[model samples]
Target: MPTAHAPGTTPITGVTIDAVLAGRLVRPLFQPIVDLSTRTVVGVEALARGPAGSALEFPDRLFAAAGAAGRLGELDMLCFERALEGAMAAPVAPPLLFANGEPAVMDQPLSPRLMELFASRPSFRAILEYTERALPSVPGSLLRLAGQIQLGGNGVALDDVGVDPMSLAFLPVLEPEVIKLDMSLLRDPHATHSRTVCAVVRGEARRTGALVIAEGIETEDDLVTAREMGAQWGQGWLFGRPGPLDGAGHRYDRAAAAAVRASRPGFHQPDGTPFEVASARAPRLPGTAEGIAAALDRVRHIAASDDAAVVVASTDDLPVSLYELAGQARSTIVLDRPVPGEFAVAVIGPGYGHAVCFRSTGGPELVMVDDLPTVAAVSRVLLNRHTRG
Candidate 1:
């Protein structure tokens, strides 16, 4: 008698998980997490794809095949090693690298592997994100291992929150440093259940001081809804699409990210005024006063001619001419001030003003227009709020 193939044991792809690990067929791609206020890249999540045109080319099937093949542990370790190697090899100083792992396998202490990865690059910060759909039967072991991970100077993030009841139970016990909101909840922020779950998660995050990142945002409305729901960080197509690390940090497109951040429909002014700016018109202006003046003049003349609802001005030094121009145009001015606002929304880059005073806020500030890409990317959002009373 030959032998019985395990049910669902048929390989989904021509390659086996063992072959993937041996051949190093798994490649790494990175998707960035944008700090909502700054619109700058804060972290990059490592995603695994198999060789081109392979059966495991996509992550879902790749992992599923591994599980069926009883090689989940091997595959997870390979992913961890590859992700760390790929991120470190990139030209830019690595941002926080988020590596995913299987919850069941992770029940064993990961300190050994983690310490090895960090041995050379001691300054590198790694956050192990758990993507398991269900809780381990003995969750205590996983919790203990999580504590060990922190002790080793690493952090843990619960990936895809609201996907299952088990994740809800893991929240406080695991005490994750970050909570990634599932994209499904964001697809319809108005859905009562989604709203309720968001509220619950937000409450937990506030209580725990864990940062919340809303993932899978596909539209501007999705971005707006994530912010309104109190997400401090966001990731999705609206920010930038995931791409291979390729050594040059190809995953991030600064100008493109800035444009999308600015064009989103609902930013607010200090007086609770709401306005809209066209992304096309919000060209990335130069950082200097002369550049600021010219961009302002151009926007002002055009807005006046079109009778547009908004004019955006972002400068390192608030020019009198720019203010005077706004006054002349009678358009509402959204100045990027150094002081805290009565109602200041979080924005990125140093030039955007208020955030500059706090160095700890970090990442890129809207300094020169280059930092954030364009005039529209800067101050327009600071002045636009939902229609107020």
Candidate 2:
């Protein structure tokens, strides 16, 4: 793939990306995701390519151009539509279609053509796969979008797990129906990092019954390692490289596809203030400014760690510690106002959620919540406020 631009040259402009979109030049290829136990095709992941024989024929170059041109959302949606079109036209489509989604583009409304495709083929089910790379920056957005996708009877997947250590923490935040382990894990299953990933992934799978798929299986040994790591499905050159779907001779497994759809996490959009949301789930305890400060320190610790936490707090006065938290957190917002009766601080990170709220009518009595969903809800509420403001 060519660089976005040669050194000293101007950046790749939107004109190129715009032309590709206008011409519908994205080529969609399907790679089979197979059941390891039965060695049968359970689904296919759609891989996007650019126009044939073009400088952007490969995805890396294509997406780089899109990103440089500030048209990633448009390009992402186009690839999704093209993939759906290809699957729809295939003589024997796989039971399920896995589509890769960029977090920056995930919040965009579904394209009209895509919506039409969904309406036309009600039986067509998809599992939207999001990588962990950009998730920490926009987790609230993903949470909201994932809920919408699940509500529409689709499923969510976390792709390229184990590539980033922080991704392990986010397992609870995403609660993905399918977890795709990075190829490195299979290649080096005995490595300490790979072992940690396997343990966390196995625990998550057992807890939620999420299907695990291992990528990068080019050898029989890789397959054995994948199975040992608890992967139920496998994908890579071992099964088949990504290619036109019609030639794969894959038979649709309706039962397996239905199972994918049934895996939706049933997430709903959280409402109410942080305190109200958390207090509803857990009781409020009497506390002092000192206690609130201690809780904020805990939030600061998480923010400073590699957990990729987001911190939001409403306070009339900004403290040095709050500033430090903002400096360390993935994203932080300090609202300058009287703290709401419901909550003053909310921290949401991978596998963690916490909130501290002061009672509106009382003298410094507070509510501190540690419930995961409640913390997520509180974080959503705070983030929404920040977005809206």
Candidate 3:
């Protein structure tokens, strides 16, 4: 069990984790991401930092080793167990925990061993991460698992967004409770190709009714940059480094959560022109499930419109998920659930559905479409509008 093995020495791949895992060598370090407005410690992202002499020191190496060893399942579960255990002791525990599980694992259905882990630890809150993942095409089972997990009360988060449009397209479909920006791609001003990437992500956040977490925040500039762009919560060394959460004082060294309050996110890019930041908007979806039906009529077409996502979301001042198909009325697929609010579109299908809720201007409207095509279609409308315009 070690964190630092001699480099280029016995190369412990994924299979090697077994030798490592057997002796108890996992240390789940936690970094706190404070809310910009409340300034409260809302959530802690559980990072699996290895032991003193383990090869699991760098996450890339650790995971690469796991993959090579075909011990992905074992690695995923062990980290899950350690982090879940760690969270129970975390003082200001956020109801949510961001653990790095990929969509593929969620797709394959947990192995018997992993199922036992979940059964034994039902209280652990996990958000699957897109980092260290090679964007596997998610299938229907993962969607079912998401619905099942949300119903169980502990939820899923779409972690490390800002990687691809595919992830953003899937946001509403998965309807994660938390969506963390891949921090690396998030604040670096997007690419020179276009600025709509940020707007797309923000619109998804606005529409899906989920929390948008910006990760990889290293300095004040990164923190200010993300918050101004409308991230609900933030992670990274800028706010706090990976350390002992309990022994952690009220603040994180010099770069504290308070900075989110002190710094304002800039709408203007480094070049000074206004970056096309997604305008923040409260949802206007209908109130009751019955009302959700009516609400979709007015906006499902809007969801299908040629307007840019930022424009549509800002105009409605609402975020939504599709629930109805042909309804020409304004009703929301609103549910009796306690979900963190963000933006997405869904259409209600004939199942005991959990809604992707939005805070809308006309009231809140929820759409519930139980498939990826429907969700991706809506996201495309948003992306295409801006690109075409």
Sequence-dependent TM-score of model 3: 0.57
What are the per-residue Cα lDDT tens digits for candidate 3 across 147-244? 54544445666666656544544555455556677765655665642145567657655555656777777777777777766787777776678866
lDDT to native, each model: 0.55, 0.75, 0.50
- Residue-level lDDT of model 1, residues 262-350, one tens digit each, is 11111111122111122233232224445434544544454344321233333333444544444332134343333331211112211
The parts of candidate 3 lying over 4 Å away from their true place are: 1-15, 111-125, 130-135, 190-194, 250-389
Pick the TM-score winner: 2
Q: What would the TM-scores of all predictions be? A: 0.58, 0.84, 0.57
lDDT of 3 at 301: 59
RMSD of 2: 5.1
Q: Residue 193 error for model 2, in Å?
A: 2.0
Better of 2 and 3 by lDDT: 2
Error of 1 at 233 (Å): 0.4
